[model samples]
Target chain A: MNSRISAFLADRLPLKNVENHIKKPLPKHINWLFSLGSMAAFLLILQAVTGAFLAFYYSPSPDHAYDAVNYISKEVLFGGFVRGLHHWGASVLVIVVFLHLLRVVAYASYKPPREMTWVTGVLMLLIVLGFGFTGYLLPWDQKAYWATVVGVKIAGTAPVIGDFVAKVLRGGEEVGAVTLTRFYALHTIWLPWLAFGLIAVHLFFVRYYGSAGTPKNTPEDMRSGKPFYPDQLFEDAVAILILFIVLASMAIFVPVPLEELADPTDASYDPRPEWYFLFLFQLLKYFEGPLEVVGTFVIPTVGFVLLLFLPFLDRKEERTSLLKRPVALTVTCLSVVLIMLLTILGAIAPRLEPVPEQPPAAEQTAPSQETPEKAEEEAVFDFGLD
Target chain B: MTDVPEEGQQRRTFFKIGMAAIGGLIGLAMAIPLVGFAISPAFRKASKKWVDLGIADLLKGSRYKKINYTFSAKDGWVETNKRRSVYVTDQGDGTFQVYSRVCSHLGCLVRWDEGKDQFFCPCHGAVFDSAGNVVAGPPPRPMDKLPVKVEDGILYVKES
Candidate 1:
């Protein structure tokens, strides 16, 4: 073989590298659960690549944004496909991540030495959430705008520093140019860079420790252990294949959500969080009334803290958290409450009612019969846009 | 799904742990609106945008003039009243010229002097020709013009 091929075979980054790094056999009994890591990686890569492409066409303006993206879908080559790819990629990333997280949890993988990895994993989850938040604003349509309104409002619920938090996020008391510019910068540049760095550290430690052994037992014979070779490669390849099919199928069929032009002044519009946030959205409802703090910062905040502290809390000798019933049960109970609360709150949240303002613009109304509710419903004061 | 303990570990004290969890979840459930309601207003401050005044006949041909107007703006919680002024003239075509009534030097309001046929910024010894160009003063640049757009018979000028 040529020297180039020889060098290529020397690394583990490519299939060619598999030749140089050939070693003992893998666990012949490896299951679908073991393949989730590669699948998550596949999805994350897709999100980053597709997100970069979509960024080129997306306008971060409250006024022209919807039209700008619409123009791309109609005008730019493959714009719709790329946008679809991005949309599905986000969902894929979240799903795959959760699966990866669960696989680790289910296997009782967050043991000693792997503690840092566990903490980093939680950070990765938060980064995914951050990605979701910032990306929502990129479209700048009514849905995105109002969703942001609710988001900022929720953040405002942060106790003593509520207004300050809101202002810091908004660059003022409300979302506008300043907010758009900040989110755009943070989304495209800041957060991604940080995520990439954190991911590198996270992955380095993961590999440094070796692919975690499954809960049952470690093999005594070295030959029985899996090498990061053909066996793993085959599974990873299969995972990539499955990921592609799912993303493509969703992209082709499910038209991405597109809202009307961004009208922050449109009071009737209700803002809801993205699907991933739906669970948390549902949680707030139960926290309503006297226990508002529990809904606001207390619960989700505590859950997030628990997620971070999992490594410290679950430091047991067993493999599956199943081995340590109490700790596992506690975490499980927390997750259940978190998800259940989210569901209830989401169901209960009154559709957002814009603070009653002056009526809608006359131009928005049809020349036909203008009924009172239609007048009321359609009537909105101009927040001053062309 | 709640985490299920191992089959072997499922026995004993189910009620105790269950009750504590139920309480914790309930407590969190109660805190939502107390936070949502309060933070919402402070979270909502105000939004403002520059209004495009279609066209106002506030300008007279090549003459120093002071035009005054008041307008209302919705600022989240309050409607703010605004005041504006400008000196107007004819700038080629159908467009008329407009300039700040405030002097370019120190922003003191300027006045039209029919006697010299010029604009005078009395507070700082500043002077301007009829076209609202600074004749002599500590001004760094010429007087700023407000954007004007005329639609129908009404003339409106930019608030900025």
Candidate 2:
């Protein structure tokens, strides 16, 4: 049976070519850290599959979007599990992509011929963020609505064509039905298409240039590189299995929550972006008004541009070692620390004020006779009920 | 090699063109409804109209009363009953000020703090005076006021 199956595959396709590709030797230093890229790829597939399942039940309209989601969670079989996987998978994909980029940076894998790979990887990271942002609005919940409003508003703060960009993003002057439908289309179709295309290019470059070995590995160690099929592939498979278990456990135990339906007219909603975006959200707090453009556009743009061109910026011929690259190490460490600090601050930061004490209904029924100064003073100091 | 027969070559050319034309027609036939279905939502206009909140007498005196009204909003193929809330304060003199419970900074619900003679948003520390003016916190504007009308003892609010 095996012989016949092999014979049929040989006749129909280039099995030998696939074997040659898969059996190529990888660097001896390639370990679990190197598996992060594969894990991201695996998670992308998982997201697409689970998202497709969700798309079957999800309604894109503002009116039915929330109901549809609720129905899926409460009515459909294992629908909540699927949604949970997709949600958690998306969050994990962001982390995996970031860690993969960090691993590449630490190994100086973005050097020389690997520049295009690094560029494609960075684009993939942005696409993943695009996925997160667009997907957040799909649930049509209060959190999704408010966060999107703030997000679109931040986009509206850009210099020159900011309003145009914001209008295009929201599909109107405000976050309404049109905005929800547009975000749904982008999340389910356009962004995923772009992600897949970029992934193809990224994989092609990885295959073309080959994997970069850790600088710590000796020349002899490099010479004894193991075949990818049983060695590197084994480690990657093990890592993916562990990731699947973790994701499944999370899905079963801590399912994603659905908040109240989005009400644009509601003014009291507190808008907070996703945790991955908390850094940018926190950064915006420091720069107000005209300087807001700095946090919203200039800084992020500069940071991304610098990242995209890091391979060109760090032109060095020496062996790739983080210890030898003080500037790169320092910059990377600082960025990681800053983002972590900002995210922590964003999570823990208190709201502007506590809930004010409510006065008795009878006292409220009576018209206020106090002067404007007294009223203002009462507003400031009186946490106690009247 | 001998030259091919003209009739046979012509027949082959005709078949190729015929096949191409048929394929093009089939593609167009398939694309019309598919594309239309895909982008139909973009052309949909928002379905919004004034919803009545019942008798105006329910909102008497200077006291603020929370009123809930339900309206059916249609978006594409789906229809849903949307619940809306407004804080109605009768000015004792005949006029009424209807404030939406939504906070101005974000879209969270705001409750009237009668003690402070203002509206307090729990999501943020934004405070709005009874008249819906921004009194404190990070709220960029005061609470929004819905257009209200009293016709034949019925209070109606224009919602969009």
Best-fitting candidate, measured by DockQ?
Answer: 2
- Across all candidates, what is each one's fraction of true contacts kept? 0.00, 0.02
Q: What are the DockQ scores of the candidates, in order?
A: 0.01, 0.02
| Residue B152 alpha-carbon offset, candidate 2, angstroms | 37
Best candidate according to lDDT = 2
Candidate 1 positional error at A54, Å: 1.4
* Model 1 segments more than 4 A misplaced: A4-29, A219-223, A321-327, A337-341, A344-386, B1-160
B6-117, model 2: which lDDT tens digit per residue? 7645654555565455445534533453344334446656755878977788767747788878898853335678888888889877878788998889889999977888
Q: What are the per-residue Cα lDDT tens digits for candidate 1 across B1-160?
A: 3456453134224433543554454334323422332234355444534444334444435454456667787432234687877766666576766677877787798888889978888897888877667788777777777776666745567775
* Candidate 2 Cα outliers beyond 4 Å, as residue runs: A218-223, A354-377, A380-386, B1-160
Residue A307's C-alpha lDDT in candidate 2? Answer: 93
Instruction: Compose the digit string of candidate 2's lDDT tens values, residues A1-386.
Output: 99999999899999999888866877677667988988999899888877876787688988788888887676565666777888898889998998998898888889887899999999988899999999999989999999999999989988889999999999999999899999999999999999999999999998877777787777566546766655566567667767877887787789798888898776556777889999999999898877989999999999999998888888894557776799888998999999999999998887655334564465455547667886675566455544
Fraction of true interface contacts that also occur in model 1: 0.00
- Give lDDT tens digits, candidate 1, residues A171-191: 898888788888888888888
